[model samples]
Target: MPLADAGLTAWSWNPLTDIQVMWSYPFMVNAFRAGAVIAVLSAAVGWFVVLRRQTFAAHTLAVVGFPGASGAVLVGVASGYGYFAFCLAAAVVIAMLPGAGQGHGEESALIGTVQAFLLACGFLFVALYKGFLGGVDALLFGSFLGIGDGQVVLLAVVAVVVLAVLAAVGRPLLFASVDPSVAAARALPVRALSVVFLVLLGAATAEASQITGSLLVFALLVMPPATAQLLSPRAAVSLPLGMLIGLAVTWLGLTAAYYSPYPVGFFVTTFAFAAYVLARAARTAATAFGARGPRPGTGATGGTPHAVEEAAA
Candidate 1:
Protein backbone atom coordinates (compact mmCIF):
# COMPACT_ATOMS: atom_id res chain seq x y z
CA MET A 1 0.00 0.00 0.00
CA PRO A 2 1.16 3.57 -0.62
CA LEU A 3 2.34 5.33 2.57
CA ALA A 4 -0.35 7.98 2.21
CA ASP A 5 -2.97 5.25 1.88
CA ALA A 6 -1.69 3.21 4.80
CA GLY A 7 -4.14 4.63 7.30
CA LEU A 8 -2.34 7.91 7.45
CA THR A 9 -4.28 10.78 9.00
CA ALA A 10 -5.23 13.75 6.84
CA TRP A 11 -3.11 16.06 8.93
CA SER A 12 0.07 13.96 8.67
CA TRP A 13 -0.31 13.53 4.94
CA ASN A 14 -1.21 17.13 4.09
CA PRO A 15 -0.69 19.23 7.14
CA LEU A 16 -1.01 22.63 5.52
CA THR A 17 -4.25 21.77 3.74
CA ASP A 18 -5.69 20.32 6.90
CA ILE A 19 -4.81 23.50 8.76
CA GLN A 20 -6.47 25.58 6.05
CA VAL A 21 -9.57 23.47 6.33
CA MET A 22 -9.58 23.94 10.10
CA TRP A 23 -9.21 27.65 9.61
CA SER A 24 -12.32 27.73 7.44
CA TYR A 25 -14.50 27.57 10.52
CA PRO A 26 -15.00 30.95 12.18
CA PHE A 27 -14.83 29.47 15.66
CA MET A 28 -11.52 27.87 14.87
CA VAL A 29 -10.22 31.19 13.65
CA ASN A 30 -11.11 32.82 16.95
CA ALA A 31 -9.53 29.95 18.83
CA PHE A 32 -6.33 30.19 16.83
CA ARG A 33 -6.16 33.95 17.10
CA ALA A 34 -6.74 33.99 20.83
CA GLY A 35 -4.61 30.94 21.42
CA ALA A 36 -1.65 32.36 19.51
CA VAL A 37 -1.76 35.64 21.41
CA ILE A 38 -2.18 33.97 24.75
CA ALA A 39 0.61 31.52 23.99
CA VAL A 40 3.11 34.29 23.22
CA LEU A 41 2.10 36.37 26.21
CA SER A 42 2.27 33.41 28.54
CA ALA A 43 5.72 32.44 27.32
CA ALA A 44 7.07 35.95 27.71
CA VAL A 45 5.80 36.40 31.24
CA GLY A 46 6.35 32.78 32.15
CA TRP A 47 10.07 32.79 31.40
CA PHE A 48 10.68 35.24 34.20
CA VAL A 49 8.35 33.17 36.34
CA VAL A 50 10.75 30.27 35.98
CA LEU A 51 13.76 32.51 36.45
CA ARG A 52 12.37 34.02 39.65
CA ARG A 53 11.33 30.63 41.05
CA GLN A 54 7.77 31.72 41.71
CA THR A 55 5.80 28.72 40.47
CA PHE A 56 3.52 28.68 43.54
CA ALA A 57 2.60 32.33 43.06
CA ALA A 58 1.81 31.59 39.45
CA HIS A 59 -0.34 28.66 40.46
CA THR A 60 -2.17 30.75 43.04
CA LEU A 61 -2.90 33.46 40.49
CA ALA A 62 -4.29 30.83 38.13
CA VAL A 63 -6.49 29.29 40.80
CA VAL A 64 -7.76 32.72 41.69
CA GLY A 65 -8.97 33.01 38.09
CA PHE A 66 -11.62 30.39 38.79
CA PRO A 67 -13.39 32.49 41.39
CA GLY A 68 -13.05 35.53 39.18
CA ALA A 69 -15.04 33.92 36.38
CA SER A 70 -17.49 32.18 38.66
CA GLY A 71 -18.19 35.36 40.59
CA ALA A 72 -18.69 37.24 37.36
CA VAL A 73 -21.18 34.60 36.30
CA LEU A 74 -23.01 34.98 39.58
CA VAL A 75 -23.07 38.76 39.19
CA GLY A 76 -24.32 38.81 35.56
CA VAL A 77 -21.15 40.37 34.18
CA ALA A 78 -18.68 39.26 31.55
CA SER A 79 -16.25 36.66 32.81
CA GLY A 80 -13.25 38.67 31.65
CA TYR A 81 -14.01 41.33 34.23
CA GLY A 82 -13.82 38.87 37.05
CA TYR A 83 -10.71 37.22 35.69
CA PHE A 84 -8.62 40.36 35.55
CA ALA A 85 -10.07 41.99 38.64
CA PHE A 86 -9.58 39.03 40.91
CA CYS A 87 -6.21 37.98 39.54
CA LEU A 88 -4.79 41.48 39.63
CA ALA A 89 -6.16 42.10 43.11
CA ALA A 90 -4.63 38.90 44.37
CA ALA A 91 -1.31 39.87 42.84
CA VAL A 92 -1.37 43.17 44.66
CA VAL A 93 -2.30 41.59 47.95
CA ILE A 94 0.41 39.00 47.64
CA ALA A 95 2.92 41.70 46.84
CA MET A 96 1.84 43.82 49.72
CA LEU A 97 2.08 40.96 52.15
CA PRO A 98 5.36 41.79 53.82
CA GLY A 99 8.09 39.42 52.74
CA ALA A 100 10.77 41.14 54.75
CA GLY A 101 12.10 38.87 57.51
CA GLN A 102 9.49 36.26 56.68
CA GLY A 103 10.87 32.77 56.54
CA HIS A 104 10.26 30.63 53.48
CA GLY A 105 7.91 28.48 55.51
CA GLU A 106 5.83 31.47 56.59
CA GLU A 107 5.62 32.87 53.08
CA SER A 108 4.56 29.50 51.69
CA ALA A 109 1.98 29.20 54.42
CA LEU A 110 0.55 32.57 53.48
CA ILE A 111 0.41 31.78 49.79
CA GLY A 112 -1.18 28.40 50.44
CA THR A 113 -3.77 30.01 52.67
CA VAL A 114 -4.68 32.47 49.93
CA GLN A 115 -5.07 29.68 47.41
CA ALA A 116 -7.30 27.69 49.72
CA PHE A 117 -9.45 30.68 50.46
CA LEU A 118 -9.86 31.55 46.77
CA LEU A 119 -10.73 27.98 45.86
CA ALA A 120 -13.33 27.79 48.59
CA CYS A 121 -14.86 31.04 47.40
CA GLY A 122 -14.97 29.81 43.85
CA PHE A 123 -16.93 26.74 44.79
CA LEU A 124 -19.26 28.80 46.94
CA PHE A 125 -19.97 31.15 44.06
CA VAL A 126 -20.75 28.24 41.79
CA ALA A 127 -23.03 26.56 44.30
CA LEU A 128 -24.99 29.72 45.13
CA TYR A 129 -25.98 30.40 41.53
CA LYS A 130 -29.74 29.87 41.03
CA GLY A 131 -29.43 27.76 37.89
CA PHE A 132 -26.96 25.41 36.45
CA LEU A 133 -23.79 27.27 35.45
CA GLY A 134 -23.88 26.50 31.76
CA GLY A 135 -20.54 25.47 30.37
CA VAL A 136 -19.12 25.50 33.87
CA ASP A 137 -16.78 22.75 32.86
CA ALA A 138 -15.57 24.83 29.95
CA LEU A 139 -14.80 27.74 32.23
CA LEU A 140 -12.90 25.46 34.53
CA PHE A 141 -11.13 23.30 31.95
CA GLY A 142 -10.98 25.86 29.12
CA SER A 143 -12.76 25.69 25.77
CA PHE A 144 -12.15 27.29 22.41
CA LEU A 145 -15.41 26.03 20.95
CA GLY A 146 -17.16 29.38 21.19
CA ILE A 147 -14.36 31.87 21.48
CA GLY A 148 -15.57 35.17 19.98
CA ASP A 149 -13.98 38.00 18.08
CA GLY A 150 -14.36 40.25 21.10
CA GLN A 151 -12.37 37.85 23.20
CA VAL A 152 -9.68 37.72 20.54
CA VAL A 153 -9.54 41.51 20.41
CA LEU A 154 -9.38 41.86 24.18
CA LEU A 155 -6.59 39.33 24.36
CA ALA A 156 -4.62 41.18 21.70
CA VAL A 157 -4.97 44.49 23.46
CA VAL A 158 -3.93 43.08 26.80
CA ALA A 159 -1.02 41.28 25.15
CA VAL A 160 0.21 44.53 23.63
CA VAL A 161 0.10 46.37 26.95
CA VAL A 162 1.67 43.55 28.94
CA LEU A 163 4.44 42.98 26.40
CA ALA A 164 5.24 46.66 26.28
CA VAL A 165 5.73 46.67 30.04
CA LEU A 166 7.85 43.56 29.84
CA ALA A 167 10.12 45.14 27.23
CA ALA A 168 10.54 48.29 29.27
CA VAL A 169 11.60 46.47 32.45
CA GLY A 170 13.18 43.31 31.05
CA ARG A 171 16.79 44.24 31.72
CA PRO A 172 16.35 45.49 35.27
CA LEU A 173 14.06 42.57 36.04
CA LEU A 174 16.70 40.15 34.81
CA PHE A 175 19.35 41.75 36.97
CA ALA A 176 17.09 41.68 40.00
CA SER A 177 16.17 38.08 39.39
CA VAL A 178 19.78 36.96 39.02
CA ASP A 179 21.09 38.78 42.09
CA PRO A 180 18.61 40.64 44.19
CA SER A 181 21.18 41.75 46.73
CA VAL A 182 23.47 43.19 44.11
CA ALA A 183 20.54 44.74 42.28
CA ALA A 184 19.42 46.35 45.49
CA ALA A 185 22.92 47.56 46.14
CA ARG A 186 22.89 49.12 42.71
CA ALA A 187 19.64 50.89 43.64
CA LEU A 188 17.44 48.82 41.35
CA PRO A 189 14.31 48.84 43.52
CA VAL A 190 14.26 45.09 44.00
CA ARG A 191 11.04 44.93 45.98
CA ALA A 192 9.22 47.15 43.53
CA LEU A 193 10.48 45.07 40.65
CA SER A 194 9.27 41.92 42.36
CA VAL A 195 5.82 43.38 42.81
CA VAL A 196 5.62 44.65 39.25
CA PHE A 197 6.70 41.31 37.86
CA LEU A 198 4.15 39.51 39.99
CA VAL A 199 1.44 41.75 38.65
CA LEU A 200 2.58 40.94 35.14
CA LEU A 201 2.62 37.28 36.07
CA GLY A 202 -0.90 37.51 37.42
CA ALA A 203 -2.09 39.13 34.23
CA ALA A 204 -0.40 36.46 32.18
CA THR A 205 -1.88 33.77 34.34
CA ALA A 206 -5.36 35.22 33.91
CA GLU A 207 -4.88 35.54 30.16
CA ALA A 208 -3.63 31.98 29.92
CA SER A 209 -6.62 30.79 31.92
CA GLN A 210 -8.84 31.93 29.05
CA ILE A 211 -7.23 29.27 26.89
CA THR A 212 -6.02 26.53 29.32
CA GLY A 213 -8.52 27.35 32.06
CA SER A 214 -7.73 28.04 35.68
CA LEU A 215 -7.33 24.36 36.51
CA LEU A 216 -4.48 23.56 34.14
CA VAL A 217 -2.55 26.75 33.50
CA PHE A 218 0.79 24.97 33.48
CA ALA A 219 -0.04 23.72 29.98
CA LEU A 220 1.07 26.99 28.50
CA LEU A 221 2.44 29.21 31.26
CA VAL A 222 4.95 26.82 32.72
CA MET A 223 5.73 23.94 30.39
CA PRO A 224 6.77 25.78 27.24
CA PRO A 225 9.11 28.14 29.10
CA ALA A 226 10.39 25.33 31.29
CA THR A 227 11.20 23.21 28.25
CA ALA A 228 12.80 26.12 26.47
CA GLN A 229 14.92 26.97 29.49
CA LEU A 230 16.15 23.39 29.53
CA LEU A 231 17.21 23.72 25.93
CA SER A 232 18.98 27.04 26.50
CA PRO A 233 19.48 29.23 29.55
CA ARG A 234 20.16 32.43 27.63
CA ALA A 235 17.03 34.57 27.62
CA ALA A 236 17.47 35.88 24.07
CA VAL A 237 17.21 32.48 22.41
CA SER A 238 15.07 30.56 24.89
CA LEU A 239 12.45 33.26 25.46
CA PRO A 240 11.43 33.66 21.79
CA LEU A 241 11.93 29.99 21.09
CA GLY A 242 9.65 29.20 24.00
CA MET A 243 7.02 31.50 22.52
CA LEU A 244 7.34 29.67 19.19
CA ILE A 245 6.95 26.33 20.92
CA GLY A 246 3.90 27.61 22.78
CA LEU A 247 2.30 28.86 19.54
CA ALA A 248 2.97 25.52 17.88
CA VAL A 249 1.47 23.62 20.80
CA THR A 250 -1.60 25.85 20.86
CA TRP A 251 -2.18 25.41 17.13
CA LEU A 252 -1.67 21.68 17.33
CA GLY A 253 -4.04 21.43 20.27
CA LEU A 254 -6.69 23.50 18.55
CA THR A 255 -6.39 21.38 15.44
CA ALA A 256 -6.54 18.13 17.39
CA ALA A 257 -9.49 19.26 19.50
CA TYR A 258 -11.34 20.27 16.35
CA TYR A 259 -11.01 16.74 15.00
CA SER A 260 -11.35 14.83 18.26
CA PRO A 261 -14.06 14.55 20.89
CA TYR A 262 -11.84 16.00 23.60
CA PRO A 263 -11.42 19.43 25.13
CA VAL A 264 -8.78 21.81 23.83
CA GLY A 265 -7.18 22.02 27.24
CA PHE A 266 -6.56 18.30 27.31
CA PHE A 267 -4.80 18.34 23.98
CA VAL A 268 -2.86 21.46 24.91
CA THR A 269 -1.69 20.03 28.22
CA THR A 270 -0.76 16.75 26.57
CA PHE A 271 1.27 18.46 23.87
CA ALA A 272 3.08 20.64 26.40
CA PHE A 273 3.80 17.73 28.70
CA ALA A 274 5.09 15.73 25.77
CA ALA A 275 7.38 18.55 24.74
CA TYR A 276 8.79 18.83 28.26
CA VAL A 277 9.38 15.09 28.43
CA LEU A 278 11.08 15.07 25.06
CA ALA A 279 13.32 17.94 26.07
CA ARG A 280 14.30 16.15 29.27
CA ALA A 281 15.07 12.97 27.37
CA ALA A 282 17.16 14.80 24.79
CA ARG A 283 19.11 16.67 27.47
CA THR A 284 19.76 13.43 29.32
CA ALA A 285 20.97 11.74 26.16
CA ALA A 286 23.19 14.66 25.28
CA THR A 287 24.67 14.70 28.76
CA ALA A 288 25.31 10.97 28.63
CA PHE A 289 27.06 11.14 25.26
CA GLY A 290 28.85 14.38 26.00
CA ALA A 291 30.26 12.95 29.22
CA ARG A 292 31.73 9.95 27.44
CA GLY A 293 34.53 11.92 25.74
CA PRO A 294 37.35 13.65 27.66
CA ARG A 295 38.46 17.24 27.06
CA PRO A 296 41.60 18.06 25.06
CA GLY A 297 43.55 18.69 28.28
CA THR A 298 41.65 16.37 30.48
CA GLY A 299 42.18 12.59 31.40
CA ALA A 300 45.53 11.30 32.76
CA THR A 301 48.67 13.50 32.60
CA GLY A 302 46.92 16.56 31.21
CA GLY A 303 45.89 20.06 32.33
CA THR A 304 42.98 18.64 34.31
CA PRO A 305 45.28 16.29 36.31
CA HIS A 306 47.91 19.00 36.81
CA ALA A 307 45.26 21.41 38.00
CA VAL A 308 43.96 18.87 40.49
CA GLU A 309 47.52 18.25 41.71
CA GLU A 310 48.12 21.97 42.14
CA ALA A 311 44.90 22.36 44.10
CA ALA A 312 45.90 19.47 46.36
CA ALA A 313 49.40 20.87 46.91
Candidate 2:
Protein backbone atom coordinates (compact mmCIF):
# COMPACT_ATOMS: atom_id res chain seq x y z
CA MET A 1 0.00 0.00 0.00
CA PRO A 2 2.82 2.37 -0.78
CA LEU A 3 0.88 5.47 -1.82
CA ALA A 4 3.93 6.70 -3.70
CA ASP A 5 3.17 4.28 -6.50
CA ALA A 6 -0.32 5.68 -6.83
CA GLY A 7 1.01 9.20 -7.31
CA LEU A 8 1.54 11.16 -10.49
CA THR A 9 4.61 10.13 -12.39
CA ALA A 10 6.60 11.84 -15.19
CA TRP A 11 4.03 10.53 -17.61
CA SER A 12 1.38 12.67 -16.01
CA TRP A 13 0.97 15.72 -18.22
CA ASN A 14 -2.59 16.99 -17.99
CA PRO A 15 -3.98 18.31 -14.72
CA LEU A 16 -7.29 16.52 -15.26
CA THR A 17 -5.41 13.31 -16.06
CA ASP A 18 -3.33 13.60 -12.92
CA ILE A 19 -6.41 14.13 -10.80
CA GLN A 20 -8.19 11.15 -12.27
CA VAL A 21 -5.12 9.00 -11.76
CA MET A 22 -4.79 10.06 -8.17
CA TRP A 23 -8.44 9.41 -7.50
CA SER A 24 -8.37 6.03 -9.19
CA TYR A 25 -6.13 4.47 -6.59
CA PRO A 26 -7.75 2.90 -3.50
CA PHE A 27 -5.05 4.11 -1.18
CA MET A 28 -5.50 7.62 -2.51
CA VAL A 29 -9.19 7.31 -1.82
CA ASN A 30 -8.57 6.41 1.79
CA ALA A 31 -6.05 9.20 2.07
CA PHE A 32 -8.58 11.72 0.89
CA ARG A 33 -11.23 10.40 3.28
CA ALA A 34 -8.86 10.46 6.24
CA GLY A 35 -7.56 13.89 5.34
CA ALA A 36 -11.07 15.25 5.01
CA VAL A 37 -12.02 13.88 8.41
CA ILE A 38 -8.99 15.52 9.95
CA ALA A 39 -9.61 18.81 8.19
CA VAL A 40 -13.21 19.30 9.27
CA LEU A 41 -12.90 17.92 12.79
CA SER A 42 -9.72 19.80 13.60
CA ALA A 43 -10.97 23.11 12.26
CA ALA A 44 -14.31 22.88 14.04
CA VAL A 45 -12.68 21.96 17.32
CA GLY A 46 -9.95 24.53 16.71
CA TRP A 47 -12.48 27.36 16.75
CA PHE A 48 -13.17 26.53 20.39
CA VAL A 49 -9.47 26.05 21.02
CA VAL A 50 -8.82 29.61 19.84
CA LEU A 51 -11.72 30.99 21.86
CA ARG A 52 -10.61 29.27 25.05
CA ARG A 53 -6.91 30.17 24.69
CA GLN A 54 -6.00 26.49 24.88
CA THR A 55 -3.43 26.12 22.16
CA PHE A 56 -0.89 24.91 24.70
CA ALA A 57 -3.22 22.09 25.71
CA ALA A 58 -3.81 21.24 22.08
CA HIS A 59 -0.09 20.97 21.36
CA THR A 60 0.51 18.89 24.46
CA LEU A 61 -2.20 16.41 23.51
CA ALA A 62 -0.79 16.15 20.01
CA VAL A 63 2.71 15.45 21.26
CA VAL A 64 1.29 12.93 23.69
CA GLY A 65 -0.04 10.95 20.74
CA PHE A 66 3.46 10.05 19.59
CA PRO A 67 4.32 8.22 22.77
CA GLY A 68 0.91 6.60 22.74
CA ALA A 69 1.44 5.21 19.29
CA SER A 70 4.98 4.12 19.99
CA GLY A 71 4.03 2.51 23.25
CA ALA A 72 1.15 0.70 21.57
CA VAL A 73 3.54 -0.61 18.99
CA LEU A 74 5.85 -1.79 21.70
CA VAL A 75 2.99 -3.55 23.43
CA GLY A 76 1.57 -5.02 20.23
CA VAL A 77 -1.71 -3.07 20.57
CA ALA A 78 -3.52 -0.74 18.20
CA SER A 79 -2.11 2.75 18.10
CA GLY A 80 -5.55 4.35 18.18
CA TYR A 81 -6.18 3.03 21.68
CA GLY A 82 -2.91 4.40 22.88
CA TYR A 83 -3.58 7.75 21.24
CA PHE A 84 -7.06 8.11 22.74
CA ALA A 85 -6.01 6.89 26.15
CA PHE A 86 -2.96 9.09 26.53
CA CYS A 87 -4.61 12.23 25.18
CA LEU A 88 -7.63 11.88 27.49
CA ALA A 89 -5.34 11.23 30.43
CA ALA A 90 -3.28 14.31 29.65
CA ALA A 91 -6.41 16.43 29.32
CA VAL A 92 -7.72 15.39 32.72
CA VAL A 93 -4.37 16.10 34.32
CA ILE A 94 -4.23 19.51 32.68
CA ALA A 95 -7.77 20.36 33.72
CA MET A 96 -6.95 19.47 37.31
CA LEU A 97 -3.80 21.61 37.25
CA PRO A 98 -3.97 25.23 38.43
CA GLY A 99 -4.45 27.53 35.46
CA ALA A 100 -6.98 30.14 36.48
CA GLY A 101 -6.69 32.18 39.71
CA GLN A 102 -2.97 31.50 39.45
CA GLY A 103 -0.42 33.87 37.98
CA HIS A 104 -0.03 33.54 34.20
CA GLY A 105 3.71 33.06 34.66
CA GLU A 106 3.22 30.14 37.04
CA GLU A 107 0.54 28.57 34.83
CA SER A 108 2.69 28.77 31.74
CA ALA A 109 5.63 27.32 33.62
CA LEU A 110 3.52 24.42 34.80
CA ILE A 111 2.21 23.79 31.30
CA GLY A 112 5.71 23.91 29.85
CA THR A 113 6.94 21.51 32.48
CA VAL A 114 4.20 19.03 31.52
CA GLN A 115 5.08 19.40 27.83
CA ALA A 116 8.77 18.78 28.49
CA PHE A 117 8.01 15.74 30.57
CA LEU A 118 5.67 14.28 27.92
CA LEU A 119 8.18 14.76 25.14
CA ALA A 120 10.78 12.99 27.24
CA CYS A 121 8.45 10.08 27.87
CA GLY A 122 7.63 9.83 24.15
CA PHE A 123 11.30 9.64 23.25
CA LEU A 124 11.96 7.10 25.93
CA PHE A 125 9.23 4.81 24.61
CA VAL A 126 10.48 5.18 21.07
CA ALA A 127 13.93 4.20 22.22
CA LEU A 128 12.64 1.20 24.14
CA TYR A 129 10.73 -0.18 21.17
CA LYS A 130 13.79 -1.41 19.25
CA GLY A 131 11.97 -4.07 17.24
CA PHE A 132 10.86 -2.69 13.88
CA LEU A 133 9.35 0.41 15.43
CA GLY A 134 9.70 2.35 12.19
CA GLY A 135 11.23 5.82 11.92
CA VAL A 136 10.79 8.26 14.80
CA ASP A 137 10.15 11.07 12.36
CA ALA A 138 7.47 9.08 10.61
CA LEU A 139 5.64 8.51 13.88
CA LEU A 140 5.74 12.21 14.68
CA PHE A 141 4.87 13.26 11.14
CA GLY A 142 2.33 10.70 10.06
CA SER A 143 1.69 9.24 6.63
CA PHE A 144 -1.47 8.00 4.90
CA LEU A 145 0.21 4.94 3.59
CA GLY A 146 -1.05 1.56 4.87
CA ILE A 147 -4.13 3.09 6.48
CA GLY A 148 -6.88 0.44 6.40
CA ASP A 149 -10.63 0.47 5.93
CA GLY A 150 -11.14 -0.25 9.60
CA GLN A 151 -9.22 2.86 10.54
CA VAL A 152 -11.30 4.93 8.19
CA VAL A 153 -14.46 3.59 9.78
CA LEU A 154 -13.16 4.17 13.27
CA LEU A 155 -12.18 7.72 12.40
CA ALA A 156 -15.63 8.48 11.06
CA VAL A 157 -17.29 7.12 14.19
CA VAL A 158 -15.02 9.13 16.47
CA ALA A 159 -15.62 12.31 14.49
CA VAL A 160 -19.38 11.92 14.55
CA VAL A 161 -19.38 11.42 18.30
CA VAL A 162 -17.19 14.44 18.94
CA LEU A 163 -19.25 16.70 16.71
CA ALA A 164 -22.49 15.50 18.27
CA VAL A 165 -21.23 16.28 21.75
CA LEU A 166 -20.02 19.66 20.59
CA ALA A 167 -23.37 20.51 19.10
CA ALA A 168 -25.10 19.59 22.35
CA VAL A 169 -23.11 22.18 24.29
CA GLY A 170 -22.35 24.77 21.64
CA ARG A 171 -24.15 27.78 23.14
CA PRO A 172 -23.24 27.32 26.77
CA LEU A 173 -19.72 26.48 25.70
CA LEU A 174 -19.59 29.75 23.82
CA PHE A 175 -20.86 31.61 26.86
CA ALA A 176 -18.33 29.95 29.12
CA SER A 177 -15.51 30.67 26.74
CA VAL A 178 -16.37 34.35 26.35
CA ASP A 179 -17.09 35.10 30.02
CA PRO A 180 -16.80 32.30 32.52
CA SER A 181 -17.95 34.52 35.38
CA VAL A 182 -21.25 35.33 33.74
CA ALA A 183 -21.73 31.78 32.58
CA ALA A 184 -21.12 30.41 36.04
CA ALA A 185 -23.40 33.05 37.53
CA ARG A 186 -26.12 31.87 35.17
CA ALA A 187 -25.63 28.36 36.57
CA LEU A 188 -24.55 26.98 33.22
CA PRO A 189 -22.29 24.25 34.60
CA VAL A 190 -19.20 26.11 33.47
CA ARG A 191 -16.68 23.86 35.12
CA ALA A 192 -18.20 20.73 33.62
CA LEU A 193 -18.21 22.39 30.23
CA SER A 194 -14.54 23.25 30.60
CA VAL A 195 -13.70 19.67 31.42
CA VAL A 196 -15.83 18.40 28.54
CA PHE A 197 -14.14 20.82 26.16
CA LEU A 198 -10.75 19.54 27.20
CA VAL A 199 -11.83 15.98 26.47
CA LEU A 200 -13.11 17.07 23.08
CA LEU A 201 -9.84 18.85 22.43
CA GLY A 202 -7.93 15.70 23.25
CA ALA A 203 -10.10 13.65 20.93
CA ALA A 204 -9.67 16.14 18.13
CA THR A 205 -5.93 16.30 18.64
CA ALA A 206 -5.60 12.54 18.52
CA GLU A 207 -7.81 12.24 15.45
CA ALA A 208 -6.09 15.04 13.56
CA SER A 209 -2.71 13.52 14.30
CA GLN A 210 -3.61 10.46 12.23
CA ILE A 211 -3.28 12.47 9.05
CA THR A 212 -1.15 15.54 9.84
CA GLY A 213 1.27 13.71 12.17
CA SER A 214 1.54 14.27 15.88
CA LEU A 215 3.88 17.24 15.58
CA LEU A 216 2.10 18.90 12.67
CA VAL A 217 -1.55 18.63 13.81
CA PHE A 218 -1.24 22.26 14.80
CA ALA A 219 -1.41 23.17 11.13
CA LEU A 220 -4.93 21.88 10.78
CA LEU A 221 -5.97 22.66 14.35
CA VAL A 222 -4.69 26.23 14.74
CA MET A 223 -3.56 28.01 11.61
CA PRO A 224 -6.80 27.91 9.64
CA PRO A 225 -9.02 28.80 12.59
CA ALA A 226 -6.69 31.60 13.62
CA THR A 227 -6.69 32.92 10.07
CA ALA A 228 -10.45 32.76 9.80
CA GLN A 229 -10.87 34.54 13.13
CA LEU A 230 -8.50 37.28 12.04
CA LEU A 231 -10.33 37.80 8.76
CA SER A 232 -13.96 37.50 9.83
CA PRO A 233 -15.52 39.84 12.39
CA ARG A 234 -18.41 37.52 13.16
CA ALA A 235 -18.15 34.07 14.66
CA ALA A 236 -21.00 32.89 12.45
CA VAL A 237 -18.86 33.28 9.35
CA SER A 238 -15.49 32.60 10.95
CA LEU A 239 -16.19 29.11 12.29
CA PRO A 240 -17.19 27.58 8.96
CA LEU A 241 -14.54 29.61 7.16
CA GLY A 242 -11.90 27.87 9.21
CA MET A 243 -13.22 24.46 8.17
CA LEU A 244 -13.25 25.50 4.53
CA ILE A 245 -9.67 26.68 4.70
CA GLY A 246 -8.60 23.46 6.37
CA LEU A 247 -10.33 21.31 3.74
CA ALA A 248 -8.80 23.36 0.94
CA VAL A 249 -5.35 23.01 2.41
CA THR A 250 -5.75 19.27 2.85
CA TRP A 251 -7.07 18.67 -0.65
CA LEU A 252 -4.51 20.86 -2.37
CA GLY A 253 -1.69 19.50 -0.28
CA LEU A 254 -2.65 15.92 -1.02
CA THR A 255 -2.80 16.65 -4.74
CA ALA A 256 0.53 18.45 -4.74
CA ALA A 257 2.19 15.73 -2.70
CA TYR A 258 0.88 13.18 -5.19
CA TYR A 259 2.75 14.84 -8.06
CA SER A 260 5.80 15.75 -5.99
CA PRO A 261 8.12 13.52 -3.96
CA TYR A 262 7.29 14.90 -0.53
CA PRO A 263 5.25 13.85 2.47
CA VAL A 264 1.64 15.03 2.59
CA GLY A 265 2.06 16.49 6.07
CA PHE A 266 4.80 18.84 4.84
CA PHE A 267 2.66 20.16 2.02
CA VAL A 268 -0.43 20.44 4.23
CA THR A 269 1.44 22.41 6.87
CA THR A 270 3.02 24.68 4.28
CA PHE A 271 -0.31 25.47 2.67
CA ALA A 272 -1.96 26.16 6.06
CA PHE A 273 0.89 28.48 7.11
CA ALA A 274 0.77 30.30 3.76
CA ALA A 275 -2.98 30.85 4.15
CA TYR A 276 -2.56 32.20 7.67
CA VAL A 277 0.19 34.58 6.56
CA LEU A 278 -1.89 35.84 3.67
CA ALA A 279 -4.91 36.38 5.91
CA ARG A 280 -2.86 38.21 8.54
CA ALA A 281 -1.24 40.43 5.92
CA ALA A 282 -4.56 41.24 4.29
CA ARG A 283 -6.09 42.06 7.68
CA THR A 284 -3.19 44.36 8.48
CA ALA A 285 -3.46 46.12 5.14
CA ALA A 286 -7.22 46.58 5.51
CA THR A 287 -6.83 47.98 9.00
CA ALA A 288 -4.12 50.36 7.84
CA PHE A 289 -6.05 51.58 4.82
CA GLY A 290 -9.41 51.68 6.53
CA ALA A 291 -8.34 53.61 9.60
CA ARG A 292 -10.04 57.03 9.43
CA GLY A 293 -9.27 57.37 13.14
CA PRO A 294 -10.79 59.55 15.82
CA ARG A 295 -13.31 61.79 14.16
CA PRO A 296 -13.94 64.61 16.62
CA GLY A 297 -16.66 63.02 18.69
CA THR A 298 -19.69 65.32 18.79
CA GLY A 299 -19.20 65.69 22.55
CA ALA A 300 -15.63 64.45 23.13
CA THR A 301 -16.74 60.82 23.59
CA GLY A 302 -16.47 57.80 21.30
CA GLY A 303 -18.87 56.97 18.37
CA THR A 304 -20.45 60.46 18.02
CA PRO A 305 -20.43 62.54 14.82
CA HIS A 306 -17.56 65.02 14.34
CA ALA A 307 -19.67 68.07 13.34
CA VAL A 308 -21.69 70.71 15.35
CA GLU A 309 -19.07 71.08 18.09
CA GLU A 310 -19.08 74.93 18.07
CA ALA A 311 -22.38 75.16 20.01
CA ALA A 312 -20.47 74.38 23.20
CA ALA A 313 -18.15 77.35 22.65
Give lDDT tens digits, candidate 1, residues 44-143. Answer: 9999988888877788788989999889989988777788888898889878877621226646676667678888898888889866465677778888
Off by over 4 Å in 2: 1-8, 11-13, 100-104, 107-110, 131-134, 293-313
Candidate 1 weakest lDDT stretch, 10 residues? 296-305
Candidate 1 stretches with Cα past 4 Å from truth are: 1-17, 100-104, 107-110, 130-134, 292-313
Best by TM-score: 2
lDDT of 2 by residue, 1-313 (tens): 2445754254367888777878787878888998888789999999999888888778878888888877877788767777888887877877776563122574677667766787787788878888555656667876767567787888888989999999999989999999999999999998889989998888899888877778998899999899887766567777888999999999888887777668878988999999898776665655454445432222222111111112111
**lDDT of all the models against the reference?**
0.80, 0.78
Write down the TM-score of every candidate: 0.85, 0.86
**What are the clash counts of all predictions, listed in order?**
0, 1
